[model samples]
Target: MDKQIYDEMIENLYWAFPLLKTKLVKPFDKEEKEKENDLTGTHMTILFMVKEKGSICISEIGKHLGICKANLTPLVQKLIDKSYIERFVDDKDRRYTFIKLTSVGEDFLDNKRYKVQEFLKQKVSDLSEADLMTLSASVAGLREILMKIK
Candidate 1:
């Protein structure tokens, strides 16, 4: 790729960042904020991680999330208070604290997932079928290109 072309692509990415965030992210953020629950985005991410991992240690969750244990503690505690998660000591080890989602946590995650899915579906409903296909193709091509990059 020509250096100038690559530079222009970088510039376009910078230009696109704010527009994409405003168009796609801000509305969702606003909607989520209006909900009765007060789970921050990071909290939701941790809940999903716990769901996917089945049960995970706080230390391990921190590692996966790039959060240090000190910062991770309060978030985990808040979830515990909400009954969204539970902490237990390992039966064999006894020293390790493992966290897992409560039924409430699972339901909470499901609700959030459905909302985002519906929101995205509604947002794209106005796009023509051909435009949708083009968007999908462009996204796939970009993914393939990124994978081939260092």
Candidate 2:
């Protein structure tokens, strides 16, 4: 990429990230709370990771989430306390603890996600078809880049 374009991208990110995190992004979190799906962003993310993997080792989860064991222990405990997740010992190795989402957790994630989708649909109802397509493409590209870096 040319220097001018690179500079503009960096400048846009500087301004856009905070706005999206605080204003655009936070509303979904807030709505999840209203639906009684209250969980910290980190916790929610961990739950989703476990949900995706079906069952995953505690250490592997910590690694994926970039949380050390000390901090991860409490977070996992919180999820347990909320009954959103459960831990089990691996049948082959009792020392290995695996984490998995409870059915309640899956339902909560799905319902909250639906609400967020509806909200987004309404918010973008004013945009023209082409603008919406552009926005969709941009978001997909951003997701791809984030996955690579993370």
Candidate 3:
């Protein structure tokens, strides 16, 4: 892409960040409030990551989320306290610990998944088939480009 186009894209991204965050944060906050849960956005993100990846080590989770170990330690501890996840020592390597979702965590995730699906369906149902397809393709392309970065 040309420099001007690239600059414009970057500028647009900067402007879109807050709007995107607001779009995500509001629903999540509402859901949490409805459930009477105190989980923060970061905590919910960690749960979602674990749900997506199944079992993962703390270091791996931190790396995947672009967070450092020091920052993730307390977050993992909080999840453990909430009984949403469990940390177990690797049988073969005592030095490594793997984190996995507990049954409660899985249930929570299932509920969240349903809510998200329902929300998306309601929000996008009015779009034409072609528009939906274009949006899907655009999202896939964006994911590919993001994966290539860093």
Candidate 4:
């Protein structure tokens, strides 16, 4: 990539991040502020990843989260303690341990996802028809491009 293009991409990312936080993240957070969370952000992330990957090995989850096994241990343990996830030793290979969300965990995630989607839908419902079309196209393009990144 040319230096100028690289710089522009960097600038766009910096600008987009705050807008996303403000327009997407903060609203749901404020609505949920009354509810106290028992799990930390990392815990929620692990649950989301496990839900996404189905049954995943401990080491594989660490790799995707950019967290080493040593640091990830306690976080995984906390989820297990909460009964949100289960760890099972692979039958064929005793050395491998896998994680998967329990029924409770799946319900928890489903509720959270539904709430966020509904909230965002209501937030954007008032957008002008043309603006909504443009926004939808921009989000589709962004998702397509971002998916190319690993």
On lDDT, the leading prediction is 4
Q: Residue 100: error of model 2 in Å?
A: 0.9
TM-score of each: 0.81, 0.83, 0.79, 0.87
lDDT of 1: 0.89
List residue ranges in candidate 2 displaced over 4 A.
Answer: 31-37
Pull out the clashing pairs in model 3: none
| RMSD of candidates 1 onward, in order | 2.7, 2.2, 2.5, 1.9
When summed lDDT is taken over every stretch of 10 residues in candidate 2, the lowest stretch is 29-38
Model 4 off-target regions past 4 Å?
A: 1-4
Clashing pairs in 4: none
- lDDT (Cα, tens digit) per residue for candidate 4, span 53-120: 89899998888889999999999999998888999999999999999999988998999889888998
In candidate 1, what are the lDDT values of residues 54-145, reduced to their tens digit?
99988888887899989999999999999999999999998789999999989988988898889988888999999999978977987898
**lDDT, candidates in the order shown:** 0.89, 0.85, 0.85, 0.89
Model 4 lDDT-worst window of ten: 32-41
Residue 13 Cα positional deviation in candidate 1, in Å, after optimal superposition = 3.9
Each candidate's clash count: 0, 0, 0, 0
lDDT of 2 by residue, 96-126 (tens): 9998989987887797678778988887899
